[model samples]
Target: MKNFIHTFHKKLQLLAAILILSGVLVSFTYEINTSPDPKKDKVLVGVLRYILKNGHYEPKDVNDDFSKAVYTKFIDEMDPVKRYFIKSDIEEFSQYKYKIDDQLKREDLSFYNLVMERFYQRLEESSTYYKEILAQPFDFEKKEQIKMNYDELDFAKNKNELIDSWRKQMKFNVLNRIQVQLEIEEDKVKEDSTYVKRDFATIEIEAREKTLENINDFYERITELDHTDWFSTFVNCMVEQFDPHTTYFAPRIKEQFDINISGKIEGIGARLQEKNDYTKIVELISGGPAWKQGDLEVGDIILKVAQKDEEPVDIVGMRLDDAIKLIKGKKGTEVILTVKKVDNSIQKITIVRDVVELEETFVKSSIAIKDGKKYGIINLPKFYIDFENPDGRNSGSDMEKEIEALKKENIEGLLIDLRNNGGGSLKTAIEIGGLFIDKGPIVQVKYRGNSPSVKKDTDSDMQWDGSLVILVNELSASASEILAAAMQDYKRAVIIGSNQTYGKGTVQNVIPLNKYYNYPDDLGAVKLTIQKFYRINGGSTQLEGVHSDIAMPDKYSYVEIGERDLKNPLAWDKIEKANYEEMDFYKNFDQVVNTSKERISNSEEFTKINEYAIWLKQAQENNSFSLNFEKYIEEEKEHQAEIDRFKDVFKHESNLEFQSPLKELDLVKKDSSLAAKREAWHKNLKKDIYIDEALKVLSELEPKNNKLLAKK
Candidate 1:
């Protein structure tokens, strides 16, 4: 069971084809404002309509069904929790539910204007309701419950009903805080017999005050968002019907995307997300200052950020963009963060900002020893490439280099891990796949109304002709899926892990609004899906990602995940197969798969993992909780017990030993941070049951050719 307060941060990385827009220019006028600009909105509608009909891989018909989807999505996006809008409000807005398509065609803003005005009025009124509710103390003795099953809930019938709903939600918040505080007090009393505990009434009042402060902070963030931001949401509701990945980025957001693509920012190199009222650290770029500092970690909450010798700015409920701006600065500068650690302890961490290099995103290799035989394990985080510079570093070259080093180590087999890779450059994927097999068609691409074009790896230099294994999960997508599909088709490698990889076969191109229009102000752009990918063997990975040769039970095994789970994802289809030769290297591939299946089934750890995944899904589906403090605490304790039982899933250690390649070892010595990171990685590898299973499989495989060993 997951806590509502400390949930994991999820990052969405798009796999796109960045192309230059040239040749044609459609004229348009632009306007900018903190409020809604009818002229600008009309222009955006016209441009998006033209692009969707012309450029999108598959465009939905602009009918009543489409209009209804947009209407529902826009309302849900505005008031997700059913807190702001009332039944009457929805009733009044339902008149235009089937007219949005007509309005879009006519460049009309009547429905949009009506909704925006009512939304603003309701938003202001909500502040008063929350303030009034918080001014009075809640009755904890009342035996009541709050149902957070938002989808099943109906809007409030009247103003009185809406106020009561807010009251219950506020009560729930305060109750959770009070329960936590009481637990801390009880723990203190257990440690020290003489420690006097505070009275329940005093603790209850304090919780109310704290909850009020948090609510105010939430409202402060709301105030920062203007009409333009809301309009962007409305636009996205329409665009997302085409596909999940296709989105409308506002001018400010587009600028940030450009900055990220260039990868030249100087910061602490930690990816963060706005988790409710706090900023949560999601990922730390390897070899970065934050990774080196060792104090910051994933799941840590940033409460405040302060520069060197400056007063700390409490960032709770702050806008993510604003929080990021404060965190980022020039290289060599120091930023101090007051963070709430995973253990609930607050501490200040100081990190000197530096250029977060693309070093960590490259390929990393390690040598594993099993039964006196050496094997190579390479972990590729993404299929990265420098788009602006041809000579800059990329994953393909780094992969080839790692393989050559591994070949020198006299490794008998090789394994590549692409577990959570979300994909990047398609060119890099093709190049890397070429290193595994002789020249062949790697993948097929098809644009709208065009025949499938094969993307071939013409190079015939097979880098490692040894036994090969690739590990993937539901998170491995796009370019990662391409390489895995190519290898599986050619029988070059055994794919293992989840049932299927992340099914992201579509290619998107960001079309800038200003590029096609004569606009005075930057009008942002739309990321339009223009192409689809197909395997060399004639299957599309659109929804049915590459099937694994040997499936394994994982934490996400039973969860709704991948492209198939997304709304309005392009359907899976097949095309004509590209001619290719399947390798004749490994012996009894079916027997190998059967052997692994038997082992996985008999293993206690794998059984426990599958059981835990089932239980976690059930827990996620449950959203009701008692407001009564006693029952609430009891429920929390039961959940915590279940969580504790599964802790060993990650804690179990293996006997296999892992070490860095010779060249990386030398580089590690010169960089202490890199050394520490590699040491931690090797330690984790020692505990990896999956890696242990992979090593066993690697040891059993028989290769037809020994060219790599012979060269060594």
Candidate 2:
């Protein structure tokens, strides 16, 4: 057995206190040959606990109180929907809840092992519950409702109660599938008026069969998991108490994280979100396999996945991450997806997995004509940079080049679209922010022990000082927030978006765990929050992201989708303002914004968007659902009607046209994929209500004798 005992370089007094506090210095060692592999995991746990204790920016005391907190988090994470583990299970596990902290300090696995055994046993028992309930068709006439938010309900008292709970959940799924099947039949009858409709019992039986398949697939996958899997979950539950972003990634997870950072993923390249036991496609990376296939779409529910020549594996009710793993595979491999489309029609689509280039993530420029004059749009997806080679392709330098090209066209104004941009490199944010002003402090960084350092853009050259508008949304975060805040603070640009951006102010550095200790295999990595960034004006964008100057009514404006929605988020604060000059670039900015607001009030698109926002809020709060099939179908129709009321809002298109860069036009013309993507993007841009309002605001931003200064 090998043990890792890192030599501490702490002060004698601190070391003495740590020893006294811990009582006994216990070290865990892993044998060369072991089945459970507690030795390696114990080392990982030890390393993380030490780092949290000694090196974390805001370390917490690891005692009984912390242990209790971790226990709650683990239980919640293990079964978020409260599907498994009855009341007795909780009582059985209560003995080790407070002892977890002491056990962790001593490298003990008693608590973890006991919890794991109980959880697996409960899951095994619940498997039978689901199968038995699903085998029998649900009673459609029963007037009952299932509480969707399981947190509001207590655990089942006995096996019978647990079976009833699973029964209701299965009934809900069965009702939805039957409703969808009936809707399809109705549509076909509408087309032909002679199509035969299946009886209710037949539909019911098919739905039950599908439910059985989903449960069987779920349990089969669960059986594939090993000790490493559960250990990762437990350790992360412990680490996440410090902050939401600070996470402990297992070796496989760390690899995925690296893949994400590289902006390249070997898969179909579709972003998936789990809602109500179904995995729905949110976004497809342009030019990726799914995008190229053109059959897959956003809002498509992927119900089943199959590899080439293999039977389809049901993904319905499976965890989103697990479902994704089944869908994603090695490059050139084919995966078939059975999806239920938005219109309730089922279809099968096959796509070959490949390393998606994410071409759309790069800085893209287009010319927009509002009257006879041309305006420029620089849509920056992420502040990407090649950190290995600083001088390589990066947002800072690439944006400068894009501006120079736009200047050659003599654009009347410039609009930077940061919507859906979750942020990337910090250095690029400062550089991009510097492009507007001659030179200034862009942001401030506060470390644990060191004083706040002002990250300044020292370049004296200004790229574009013309009319500027920065577009953001609830998803716009970190670097996006920094750039928007800097521009807003300097009075250089009008920030417009949902009510605020995603308020993630903290900075993280991913440390490889193996680097700290010797290990034969990969030991994963720890992403630690070491610092928090602040605006040059001194306010931190922690929870309250930068408020838009012109608050636009968007879909997520009313939802709690920002960093504040996360657990253990850092608190917002302010530091000493950095020394910087504020240019009076938009003296009439307020007036222009007010006029736009008035127009927005009168505009159909804006009004409809606001209505949709209200509807979204109602939908989020409407958790409980009717288990009776008739009521459920009627409720779905009402929901669809409400959506239909606002359907025309998204279809509203501006008359303006977007132009491709002259140099790339020929290349784009030759590449069918690029041409198709550009066409699709231009179509969306025309339909963008926020962009329409942005353009209107730009037209209104006509300066009082060059108030839109051209700084030299």
Candidate 3:
């Protein structure tokens, strides 16, 4: 479920701000005369005057040219594509611009008819082209086969064909989904209902009629679907548009926006992305049905979906919204998906839908020993915890359990592996940070027109008072930033890994607009940027993410990645600091820092990473590589040599048999051999220079208390 806000209220707020700034003695009034051309120039002037007086713009002149400039600017900002109106459409729209003198008014039927007619034509064309493509077997040989080469195609023909194809495919997909749902519902009624008032014939007839009605409803509502790709093209052709951020949400799209913001819904619990005409799996939630089944994997293509014991419906070329509806069902119902694997093999999987609890996203850990030293390795897949379900076990709680297990093992130091962690619950972040430090504010949230709220680590007990090191990369974000920032702020632990974190300091409010309003179908939701997070010292983790205390060589260089490269991202800012005491362990951090630097310089893994980085930089700059058969073979051989050089260090065993680390036979002897093997293995794992450095750092910083106890 998502929180819904009124769209009308949002608009009113803007309008109120404008009115306040104008300071008009009397309310300005003008009547818009209905005409074929509403005098676009006049409307442009009125809008510019209002904006200059009230909006952010402060114009020096108030003339017709100025009005045109404002109108042009609005058009450019609002619509980048000229698609909504071709030259003729623009000319048609310009006829009635004069009607904008007083209140904003337009001939609703005329404007709607113009847009609707164009949309219908596009739909019809899309339907026709889709049918033609469906008539032939889909070719899967080419990875980019579904891509539309618009530049190469005849403009008019291509546009019409593409539109028709899309429409037909969407219609077919919608019809198929309705039929499946109806059948599934019908079966449930037969099984659960006690009363047998109606015969099988009546039930069958009613289900058929219901399915038909659904199909008709979808067809009629096609106009409401604000497919942004189509609108983007339309707006681009119009002229100068506004910032790309400002976009209109169609009724259907509103539902999608809602689902996106909430992050949890009654679906298969899989992350999906649109690739050409297909919805590809970006990632599988660790404990979700897909992951549990072990059939569906990352990069797998969803081809179709089916109801239990029913014919599988092909979903290729179907809209993502429609596909999602088919997959999402009431909890405990089974939905089968037909998936095309990366290996070009196809399989059908049936999943019993359930509430996608966020706790499932976290991975817990224990300890591993090599020689006499205890190594605490907590493998965190993501920083996830479900705030909506307070009673549910969260990532923080799971981590606490792992720490308890490590404490029992008498671990000397800890390794918090945050590799590939995308982040999750903010609440869990604060709680986890509490485990490191005694007490203090963990993170701050700043919202529009509101004082910043400080989230503190209020927990009384510290889980681990020993040495700690956090592992991170470019992928770590949101809650990951929160935990890493807190640890750095308190000087409680050493931050090691990539140059910087993924700077996503803002928080979004997922408002479900449809939940507040009644409509034929789900209206969707909006994910609005309502708040930004700041560190305790006031420095924001915006474009500049948390910088690690000690930097090491990473496969991905700082030059190629991080938040600075992102567009339209919020800028970093600072605020007043809160009171806190720094940890004593970090007082001599410079000594530890210098020692690690010197060690890395002498490290073979670091040297290899530096070489690899140089090679990558050269390749990117040159952009010219040998394609000649002989040269290509030679280049490949050279690449193999680099791989071979690093392979010798790990002493990697190809036919290595699995052994239970839990076995208790001559533990010290078993540990000594494993430790020797790992040291040798470390030399080969050059690709992960950060991990190599982390291990070395841990060895140097090994708790003196544990060492002294062992000697005694």
Candidate 4:
């Protein structure tokens, strides 16, 4: 009895310790809010938060700043242009400005629900504003301007103020239409003296009708978006605070993302992006309907899309996915796009939708004889791989075969063009890097809570040992940087292009959240940034991609397209340099690089490129546009003249004929797409000044004996 009494105090202390730990654990766990949708979506919020907090490579604390960031991003996603929501609404939402992290920790979405509910109410109010304004015709003779860059403007003060903002915006939209219609009617008058031309009143009426139709489609599209669509915005807003590339893809959206990454789609293959409320073509899928037709071009603003025999639906100010839904359809169906060309001329282009296989994404090569020395140019669009099949066609293997074919042709030098390659499998990157360098470390990867590991090219046999040069652009990313940096580090290849690559070095793994829960339906997936990659020389590419060995002026040299411009991008870092050995680089590497830079400095084309880049930078900076029709027309003509002047600079064609890789002769004969795309590619190469300069650099890289044979 005496011994038991002595230990009673010890037992009491132990009990207190257990209770404190339990309370801490419970406090950190999430709790569901009272809203019906929150009750349903609480699981996603919890899972996404847990993954980001735990698995993310550079996780931020769930603190006041993070909560503030979420609030700001969520509001921006809802209304990017400040046309909706007043300053009062923002202040009201600020109550949860510091409490969002608390709500997230408690698994509550009271703030989200309140803000979104108010957003819908504002949406309803704004819909009336557009309709009321469009009912009356816009006065084109009025001298006014609309701020095209919404980021530079502040939100409205109240509902009436919001209506006035919408009035100006709607007036501007109608003015654009009236001006185009007036130009068309004027052109028709030139064709025939008696051609009955519509008057200004009729033109104005038509513009109003078009504007009303566009707004109607917009409202209808919003109606189609359910809770899932809204929730995606909230979820992504949370994840994106970690990094720009980190994202949360909802179920259907994930399917589309997978299709995009797979490099295949069953629709009219044209990539689109929203810039200043207009959907512009970012690029075209080669061998796809858009590329084959060649009517829709880069920088073309798609104003509307229509099915066969149906009235065109205006896509202006519409969300990207909604416009994509209208444009994408079953294979063999036709979709017509009403596009405003870069010259500000409007036209309709028809592209028959087809199953765009993205054959161009695969490694394609050609034999180019420059200075009489045979050189091989291999264009790798991306580091593509069939993840489902281990032995399937992948960049690494396809590249090996292409190199072998080029070697068989007795090529003396090689140009591995990775320009615009946004990267894929790390395994393929390693394998491809091995082709040039001997067995050595290619890249280093760092994960949270673990020592950085070195990924290597273990192959002892060398593949392409010739003098090499790699082409890159600002669009080149991830695995592309890995290969380029490795080659640069080993001095195995000369890197050229934009000032730097896209600077995306973080690695993401898309984990389907549904896999972690016992829930019945799909819960979508979280693209978690779990690791970062570094060059073998210890430099990370997080925000400073791989710097080019020979920096050249390109379109994006003065543009802010790199990762450093993105929101909350991960910080660049370094680790100990990985073990590697240098390859036998070109003996005259320094001489060649120096000569090339000197030539580019003196060339008229380079001068024009630099001038055009300056003009582009200025144009990007000036976002306010006049609503006056005459002034707008005058501005368009000025821009067209400026763009046309640069045409001659980019128009210098090289007399280089490229042949199919020797091993692909039979395949090229059998595959019409293969033959067609290569022919098209070779034709462009003939017109490529960059490739022409690259060839000249290759000539200088060759030794005297090699140069003499090349000269012959």
Model number with the top lDDT: 1
After superposition, the stretches of candidate 2 with alpha carbons farther than 4 Å from their true spots are 1-35, 190-194, 259-267, 272-313, 317-322, 325-355, 389-391, 519-521, 665-673, 702-712
**Lowest summed-lDDT stretch of 10 residues in model 1?**
7-16
Q: Which digits, one per residue and each the tens of the lDDT, describe model 4 over residues 392-433?
A: 899999999988878778887888888767788898999999
Error of 3 at 109 (Å): 10
TM-score against truth, every candidate: 0.87, 0.86, 0.55, 0.88
Tens digits of lDDT, candidate 2, 301-378 = 898899999978887767666776788799999999989765444678999998777566689888889998888888
The C-alpha stretches of model 4 lying farther than 4 A from their native spots are 1-37, 190-194, 255-265, 273-283, 293-301, 307-310, 330-334, 339-350, 665-674, 703-712
User: Which RMSD values do the candidates have, in order?
Assistant: 10.0, 13.4, 17.6, 16.7
Arrange candidates, best TM-score first: 4, 1, 2, 3
Q: How accurate is candidate 4 locally (lDDT)?
A: 0.78
Q: All models: lDDT?
A: 0.81, 0.79, 0.54, 0.78
What lDDT tens digits, residue by residue, belong to model 1 across residues 85-150?
Answer: 999999999999999999999988777777877887787778778767766666555688899888
Which 10 successive residues of model 4 have the least lDDT summed? 21-30
Model 2 TM-score, 2 decimals = 0.86
**Whose TM-score is greatest here?**
4
